[model samples]
Target: MEETDHPQYCGIGIRGVAIGIDSFVWIALLFVAIFITAAFTGQLETGSPGLNAELSGAPASMALGLWFVLALGYHTVFEWRFGKTIGKALVNIRVTSEDGSSLTFTSSLIRNAMRFVDWLPALYLIGIVGIAVSGQRKRLGDRVAGTAVVGS
Candidate 1:
């Protein structure tokens, strides 16, 4: 019997879990950064007026902006250099080209950049549907980038 060349694609459940883990990792890093900055500025003490003011008047927009940059950097760098994020590694999955080759920087950037589209309508419903319908189990970003997630 001849062996097949087809890749074993990753399903949405595992992908969703991996994303959840990645989200937690990013959130933890953000919290650590905030605490470190607060400590450096001598605002770590709860009773300190500076700390109270900082917390009370904190700009959520700034945090959201930082999060956007962090996520873009994290996903792009990992997929470009390693073909897998920490979450994907833990899940034993990786992203690769449609031809089953290593991901290129351009492909990684395209996929990660289109994450906004995948997140449309909340909770990645569009991406979920796309992956389900795609024979190779590709999300919008993956399809646009000519990439797919598969078992490592």
Candidate 2:
């Protein structure tokens, strides 16, 4: 019998692990960048009397803004260029179009952009439900972008 053209979609177990890895990677990178910048800017010097080294007020807001931009960029750029983030690559999986073709940059951007919505009420609960109910195991972002995560 001839084989059907169905794709082997990854389950939440593997996808969750991949995202966990990616989150760690991004956080580490963000910290490193912040440390280097602080060092260069004398923010880490702690040389003045009655001075505290802490993120607060403007600094806190700026850091939060930076984190958002960097995280979004991290996901969007990686998937757009490689069809997988470093985490997904390590997991031996990659994102592809529903038709099993390599995804375009717009597709990657659209999916990654919807990540915040997928996060839902908290901790990807909505995404989990979507994946569980979808025939292709797609999360909100995947369904919206017509993409799937599959073994590479």
Candidate 3:
């Protein structure tokens, strides 16, 4: 195949940095949700209760559910529609099919779902190792989904 037929695979370092950026964004949103929920429910009173206690309440449960949905949606929608999340776009990398075609929703869902496994043993140690060992720099999710992260 011609060089153009195969996009450049993104290495673990850049991918890690991109994920770090995304994680920061997610955390910020989570905090905002928590504060908003707390404010509405009068849980923000000084010294009324611990932050953890407040977070374990109904509003926090809603926020947690929202976070879960948002996290899955973030990856699925972005990868399926644009082939990149905000962080991936900023980093100039994207998820694509092994054949370099546009990514599909099913593939995106599969990869994102497999993230549970990738996150094994904390901090994605398994994912990092998978990326390192795979010739195409594919993480477990990528391998399972038949996709790859590539420079755009």
Candidate 4:
């Protein structure tokens, strides 16, 4: 890790507002998925067709999966290309290592891929505790990847 005026600081500026932006974006994606499904397949009635029900679940799962992948893609690509995600861009923050170096692709993948682990045991139990207790607001993946989120 590199030393700076704020040696122990987390990255550029991924703060509460970034969290809010992430929530809004994800919720909008979810709702849009729902709306699109309904628009093409018909209303979600109690006694909907069985085939429709099955297709609905598959499509819903696909939509969620797509969102998951895209979110990672956005973060990885934007961060590497522009040093920010959409939310991070809006907030003027960037992610880096403790030494102020850009995160490698593998490192970014490890961090984002382990998001499932941090979200383990339901309700983000592990992640919540980790971030809360961590001095730099690092969750498991961040620690493992030896990276930090900071203001740019």
Specify the highest-TM-score model's number: 2
- Tens digits of per-residue lDDT for model 4 on 31-64? 6555556545665445454322233576677667
- What candidate 2 gets wrong by more than 4 Å, as runs, is 1-4, 36-42, 46-53
Pairs clashing within candidate 4: 11-149, 11-150, 11-151, 12-150, 12-151, 13-150, 13-151
Off by over 4 Å in 4: 1-8, 11-14, 28-55, 121-125
lDDT by residue for model 3 (1-152), tens: 24657678998899998998899778876776777677777776566564532666677787787776678778888899999988898899999989898888999999998987998999998899999999999999999999999998
Local accuracy by lDDT, each model = 0.83, 0.81, 0.85, 0.67
lDDT-superior candidate, 1 or 4? 1
For candidate 1, write residues 42-99 as lDDT tens digits. 5566764543414323444454556677778899999999999999999998999988
Error of 1 at 70 (Å): 0.6
User: Candidates' TM-scores?
Assistant: 0.81, 0.83, 0.81, 0.67
In angstroms, the error of model 2 at 81 is: 1.1
lDDT of 2 by residue, 5-124 (tens): 866799899999999989898887677556544554467545457433356566656666676778888888888788899999999888988888778888988898888898989999
lDDT for predicted candidate 1 compared with the true structure: 0.83
TM-score between model 2 and native: 0.83
In model 2, residue pairs whose N, Cα or C atoms come closer than 3 Å (at least 3 residues apart or on different chains), thus clashing, are: none
| Model 3 lDDT, full chain set | 0.85
